[model samples]
Target: MAEKFTDEEFAFLRYARFGSLPERVKLEELVALNETEPAPDYSDLAYDAKERAEG
Candidate 1:
């Protein structure tokens, strides 16, 4: 089965695939302006994947 994705996962995937740092910062700015919840922790996701592979 395909992996499930949280909102942060989708954002991180989009950022990694198509966004520069400036773009990400801009997205954050936009989210803040709109009073949206913060995106998920992509680094945590990455760490979890690495841990799964190593173990």
Candidate 2:
């Protein structure tokens, strides 16, 4: 089994990984980014191994 990290260790890990962003992103910008992309079409995609093997 793996050992659990303490609160101090977890804080240190988060700081080391992400540090701090120079500027905060606006909520509007985030919403616009998501809206800009169209959802993908998976209508013709195979859902099983048998279908994949046949094709």
Candidate 3:
């Protein structure tokens, strides 16, 4: 089975895969912004209904 990832984890994965120095820096900026900002509600985001039903 595949593992689920958080937004931060996905960002890190992107950094590990195809990111350049600038991209890494931008990711850091995004992290900092996230830390300072209010968290977003993800209830409206798309999800796999089959996976949810299976779980």
lDDT of 1: 0.81
| Candidate 1 lDDT, 3-33, residue by residue in tens | 9999999999998998755623455455434
For model 3, residues 1-55, the per-residue Cα lDDT tens digits are 9999999999899989987455235544554333466555565333555567779
Deviation from native of the Cα of residue 18 in model 2, angstroms: 0.3
Judging by lDDT against the true structure, name the best candidate: 1
- Per-residue alpha-carbon lDDT of candidate 2 for residues 1-55, written as tens digits (9 for 90 to 100): 9999999998899889999556887777775333466644565343455587988
* TM-score of each candidate structure, all chains considered together: 0.35, 0.35, 0.33
Q: Count clashing pairs, candidate 2.
A: 0
User: On lDDT, who's better, 1 or 2?
Assistant: 1
Off by over 4 Å in 3: 21-55
Clash tally, candidates in order: 0, 0, 0
**Range of the 10 consecutive residues with the lowest summed lDDT in candidate 1:** 23-32
Query: Candidate 3 at residue 37, lDDT?
Result: 62
lDDT (C-alpha, whole model) for all candidates: 0.81, 0.73, 0.67
Alpha-carbon RMSD to native, per candidate: 21.3, 8.7, 18.0
